[model samples]
Target: MLPGHADFALPAPAAPVRLNGRRPIPEVPQMNGHSEAPSANEVPPANEAPQPTRSEKPAEPIDVWDQRVAGALAFLRRRLAGNYEVDDFGFDPELTDALFHPMLRVLYRDWFRTEVFGVEHVPVDGGALIVGNHSGTLALDALMLSTAIRDQTRAERHLRLLGADLVFRMPFVSELARKSGATVACNPDAERLMSQGELVGVFPEGFKGIGKPFADRYKLQRFGRGGFVSAALRTGTPIVPVAIVGAEEIYPILADIKPLARLLGVPYFPITPTFPWLGPLGLVPLPSKWLMRFCPPIPTAHLTEHADDPMVVYNLADQVRETIQATLLELLEKRPDPFGL
Candidate 1:
């Protein structure tokens, strides 16, 4: 004890308070010096606004159209700045995705009402040769086929097409073709693309298939010398046979003007129902329901040694031709009316 508080004594402790035979809860002091606590079920005063629960909070709005516009503008800026990549074959994937594919998607989806089947047969990775029947007079089937592959497959693989020499000879068309992943149709290019694990697309039927009259619509023309088969074999790439229906009906060729075709240095001068009669307006393709089916891939890995064997190449080419023909017939049966929904 200190000298000043020597006489001070500790106060006696208060007895414990109980209510309802249990320890009493201490009251909470309020700002007004009141020791009463609010009840658990008490409601706020009428003057006070109710607080919003977590679920009742407003969410920030998102404008999808605005976002798309902004994205397109940015893509344009990048393109103008030359800030994009192009492969050795002159394939500009960015341009293909942003420009070419979007434009073709409109034709592929709304105009043609294209449907794809057996897309799973296309490998996610590695080289493959896709041989398809060519028609539609303008090679529109190739564009549609490329669009279908991108849309249906899980990986959205780009198909490197083999274009004719005439296609590469044109001024504006050549640039577009190269940018869209097309190279000159030759064994060296085909083998190179496949060996590098690119999905290469080829129309072995060539001009014979696309230039045929509507009378011979679905009848496939001769697949050239099986050069595509030899290329696939050399690269040890799988060959995927594809059948395309409805392209023939799009620009039904009534006749071929041989003299005019010769004069213009073109393979054929097609005389469609509306072509010369309708003038520029006739260039528009008719709305035809398109069906594309990819057949099971024929493995060439085991036949690499027989790449130069003419007999082996012939048999494989025949098999692919037969598969495509059978699939085309099946698709035709399914779509009885070319323009049917």
Candidate 2:
């Protein structure tokens, strides 16, 4: 009270630390299961701080479409790596019913109205070589045959198409051919696929078949050196003569390879015989319809295992060629319109 101002008392003593909000720190035991309490002046080591858990990981955003696409890719990888049988290689009858039948219903139900004959020739199960005339300019024939096989036989066998070098030589086209199960027309590849109980389809004429002059339409071209025969004999696969009508008239070539075609490095130049240089409107197939028939299967089972005999291979090739040629002639004579609709 004797001090300067009695009313101005000293500051109240500082409040003690309130530890109520503080957590009870966990006791991290030492190697001996006992820990030394830290002193006021002690400092922790560099790595002594608590580490983050997996729950602390940042979230990665994913779009629904991307996730779906990834799932599909994983499924496909598994399918391709699994023991893929002919029926399981996306060629299953059920898969055909699901995807192909719908497409056919759209493309051919009432509009295309296809009629097939001699489809019974395709065996229930075994290797077979299908030799057919190729036209439609763009291999619509191949696609059509695939569709027919699925629909008629209820067999989901893929045709191992033997395409020309030009097929693999093209940029984007090569991938499309491969997706369609085409491979290079080499004996080794053909024989290997056939040996695996696969059906091998070949257009021996290659580009020569598709681009032949209108004057030579419907005429059988020379069979290539019996290479296919050698493969068939080696694998004991039967040969099925196939004749396709209505394809030749799809795009009738009037003119042949010009300088531009040579520049493009294609075998023969083509000008579809039509008006206005066959303007976009005229490119449609003439609605001639399509007829495909698989003739009787030519069995190689009787041929000796020593089918390496050149004469035997050649004779078999000639027989296949003749059978296909005769069938084509018969079909052409019998059909009223090319498509047989």
Candidate with maximal TM-score: 1
Alpha-carbon TM-score of each model against the true structure: 0.81, 0.67
Model 1 lDDT vs. the true structure?
A: 0.84
Model 1: CA > 4 A from native: 1-66
List lDDT for all candidates, in order: 0.84, 0.65
After superposing candidate 2 on the true structure, give the runs of residues whose Cα lies further than 4 Å from its correct spot. Answer: 1-112, 279-283, 304-307
Model 1 clash pairs are none
The sequence of per-residue lDDT tens digits that candidate 1 reaches over residues 1-341 is 66776552211111211111111222212343332224311322212333332223344224544677899899999999999999999999999998999899889877887766677788999999999999989999999999988876768899999999999999999999999999999999999999999999999999999999999989989988999999999999999999999899998999999999999999999999989889998899999988788887889999999999999999999989988887888778868789876
Error of 1 at 155 (Å): 0.9
